[model samples]
Target: MNSLDTTRIRSYFDFPAAGRVVTNNAASTQPPRELIGLLQRCAPWYENVHRGQSTASRRTTAMYEASFDTIAAWLNAPGRGCIATYRNTTEAINAVMYSLLTDFRDGDNVVTTMLEHNSNYVPWHALCREILPRLGRRVELRLARFDATGRLDLDHLASLVDKRTKLVCCTGASNFFGTKPDLSKIRAIADAGGYPQPTGERRALLLVDAAQLAPTSALDVQALDVDYLAFSFHKMLAPFGVGVLYAKRHLLDHALPFLYGGDMIADGGVTTETVAWNDLPWKYTAGTPNILGVIASAQALRLLLDMVMPTAFFGGSGPLPRVAIEEVMARVGRHTANLTARCMAGLSEIKNLRVYGPEHRTPLVSFTIDGISPFAIAEALDRRGIEARAGCHCATLAHRALGLDPPATCRLSFALYNTPDDVDLATDAVRETVAGRRRAGRPRPGRAQVSTAAGRPT
Candidate 1:
């Protein structure tokens, strides 16, 4: 087994696990000491940024801008690309969707995949709704289907993407299945399909929601050749209320701002009120912005990068490409394999347990027992000192796609810090709960009933 120093990671998170299994990385990650220290150091400088003319405000503003530069370097975005700060991934998605809808005429279609997070799915779908009525032309929306293995159907995806498609929104990785779509292939498809004369044919702009990929792995924006990318720092072990939306500066120059406010408005007249927008990123990023959160997020990015540097994470002697996600996943797969083995072994002892998602999937496993509801399973595990996520983890459409309606299954996600022992403990708890229910010959009291929703399992 490829060993990970999970004890060290647990120490870093300061996990207060008196006992039982630990399984709570999917919701949010724990920031390291350095990031926490960075936040604490700047906590006192909470003056209003961009609004104040004072030196304190100036310092904060400078720091905030510097944070953007740091993030750009971390993402390896184009030198002139704009990194507009935002509230979260949802806001970033909104900005991009607004930009696309404002620029493109009606009847222009958006091609996305089933693997996308709701943040990526909702905005574009809403945009389609808004624009479809304006012109007689209908807005076409398509979802690239995934195979039974939960991997993207690349051939089908390519077939769906055509000249009418104005934008292709894809995720860097799936939060549900922990499947990293082959971005290199997606980029190739985009390059082949995108507009006019240069690369033989023109197609659609590729926008990647890197919310899941960026924190866990490095990205090369140029190499990917995507038109736009968005991610959140909160999921990357940074403080909340800070996310990034990166687009080629030229493209951003043409797009309309999603919101209009202080920092984004150049000037406005008092009379009938005429207003001019700011330049590039600042045009989209309205108001004072999340200065402290930005700074802290930058620190958080550095912390995660340091921990999973290409050399250490990838397990090779020669220098690994910092932005190669496949290499990282290959390494992570090794980690997952170890955990999976332990989990499967322990789960084998249990009767009537149904694990969801792809078999031989990542460390994450969404499952249900024959007679128990997801909530009961989560509660049972919680009482046993193990924590897991239950319910339709925000991907309502994904659940529907899986043919599961109403409440979802229990989702146990693993982090780099999670150990085989944790998996064993979790499996033990699950087995014990199943056995208890079976022996009692009755449904456990307070246990929830099976969901009546109608989506297929992914």
Candidate 2:
């Protein structure tokens, strides 16, 4: 199954066998069975990496290190040296925050936007509001606004960045709105801030939380020219537990390690008076890492390629071809985009249901009905065997910005394996749920029949 072949692609996963509708992919993609098997196979030989001399140890270490290379190629980064794995995107973003702790001077501000997931916003909030202030260095956290249509206010974002702005953080895609911001334009705005760095560059550093974008999009860090980028593998059909942080080599070389011990130290370079950190990527990787998760996550990317291409990549390892990567992701994007549109069209017919964001969105639709709680809607969908996510989706700020009374919405997100039928089912499920609510309450006979759409199958 290539990117366009959902029938073949869905075969690799166990979800279809179970007759499930997995529309909450923005939270996490269901793992394909081969990855689980690959993970299980590593159990017998699993050994602590980079510290032992045994054959099993060396083998694990080699595969572990090569996973970095695969991740780098996936992002079109310079090399493995730029990739650092973490538990998830949240921790990866926190890593950057800790690494830059002392870099913020008094009165300096970090400008982020209202569309951020709490993973992106909370860390900066704690850093500037809690951590830095107590240490007698007061840094400010500024939020740029988004419009009623869920489009980011780019002009407002630019105005938020000035000489005092040390870094600008933004989401590449909104998990709630499903809106993908123009990263190149955001990069230009960040550069225009022109905050002088210690390295002599005159620009505020830009960090992107790409948790929502990386699944279907081909993310080229070089092309984006972002200083730092973070994304989680769980959202990309890889099993949970691994995320990646891509920083410019120079920034990694200069910044202090967020966590220090074990492998992060230079092999024999630790001394009482002086200590040397390891090379580019490892300098940031401290302690015994999530070995199996990293390796399997890398293979997950390979499996994605194999699903999209006539040939296979999961059977092999190392750098993926850039052209193939681009083609595969574009195909996946187009497929999911079509599915989202279809889902929206089916959803639009329902009375009192309102979808968020502009017409063009990522592979997700978040919406709410006037009289129903989103949580209640999600529970009703669950009874129908459909998987939908409710509440803020960790985008509390975006919800609050929209003046959502309870600050929540029901969201249906898609992946490569999601079918048009799945979208229709989810949308129909929402319609039925809304119709059910009307029947239980004070029902208008005419609107009730219309809402329930008795002509359609329940």
Candidate 3:
């Protein structure tokens, strides 16, 4: 298989010039210089959307609203009416929780997995434990466990769902485990549960947290048959502060809005007697939205394809070819997979280093050296100019389930811009850090006393 032209891709990012080895892509990818430039280009047309009659407001509104179309096309949703913007993946998932707050019956339940990030898990936890109980509802939140190798236990998940299950929320890819659950099988399980919803459906609604998956995969909400999907643009190449929630047309049409205020109401229809909501998507967009962020996030999707392939697709609008999207993402997935494999191979050679997740998984590896704190490992890697992340990575449940003392692991994740050499440098740094610790006697106790020596643990 051919590799991506990472040299050309690296040139588009400013991080390479600063001697930074950005391997923490699963957390957030570095924005390309062109994306930053695009933001500046929009400065001339600065105004709030859906407000005044001035040319600036009209132009900004057009661009901002068109952004919804671009995002819908990227996800292969039916249309822009199915899309709603949010601050991030956490907020997007919260929106779903709030929208269906009253719809959940007293005896109903929500089924999620141990492989989820807190963004997907915490909201349901709060709904079942804190919020709903206070409202005199006894909604149960069931958690499905993972296998010994860090894969989602399908049988365990199937056993958790029943007729009373209202929703099944799962992550498209696990941030800590790097495991991608088979969505089709999950959809089937959800359907077989025969849960009755207010919308006359007999199956539990499927909500996929695609935060980690969307950055490196081709996501089609229609093909997956997911009722709701959420992902953040910062994980891809876009700037921060923009996330998306794609729901079926009927759901958005019938489900209550998450927030209500200004623009969500119909034009001049806010009478004292009764207030009518706006159209499909506008009804979801309350207040003056993040106009510039939405536009930039849509453009980021275009720029991602252009960055992967040699052809230019930026500064355009309309539906992207599914074939083009698949081909580009396939190339990206293969490249990152190869880099991750190399890192795993190198890390496995080091003594007492325990790597989490399956050997073949997403383009990331989380591991810990025995007797060494992951925080110290991250700091040592930082001194060596390798940007990696440590902690539960918002995957607190999975880490605790694995019996990790501090519930943390040091993670090195890859992206399209990361080359094979970057993987080598990172793994080599880990080996050195571990070896230095062995030479310096036993590991020390406490956080402040941990060693920062290259290849050494505190």
lDDT of every model, 2 decimals: 0.70, 0.91, 0.92
lDDT of 1 by residue, 1-458 (tens): 23445555566564544553567666666666666677677767767766778887887887776667677766676542467878888788888877666455545678898887888887777667655556554787888988776788899999987766778889887777767788888877666665442223375788998876765455778778777899887776676788788887767767777887677876452235567776655677677677778778776654443454323421111222345434444455466567766776676667787665565554567777776888888898898888988887666666678787554878777666678778878888888888777777654577754544744322
Better of 1 and 2 by lDDT: 2
Candidate 3, position 138, lDDT = 96
Per lDDT, what order, best first?
3, 2, 1
lDDT of 2 at 84: 92
Regions of model 1 farther than 4 Å from truth: 1-4, 17-22, 134-137, 192-201, 266-276, 306-349, 359-363, 442-458
Model 3: what TM-score? 0.95
Per-residue CA lDDT of candidate 2, range 117-215, in tens? 999999999999999989999898999999988989999999899988899999999999998889999999999988989878899999999998999
Residue 250, model 1: lDDT of: 68
- Between the candidate structures 1 and 3, which one is better when assessed by TM-score? 3
In candidate 3 the C-alpha lDDT for residue 330 amounts to 86
Off by over 4 Å in 2: 1-3, 442-458
**Between which residue pairs do clashes occur in model 3?**
432-455, 433-455, 433-456, 434-455, 437-456, 451-458
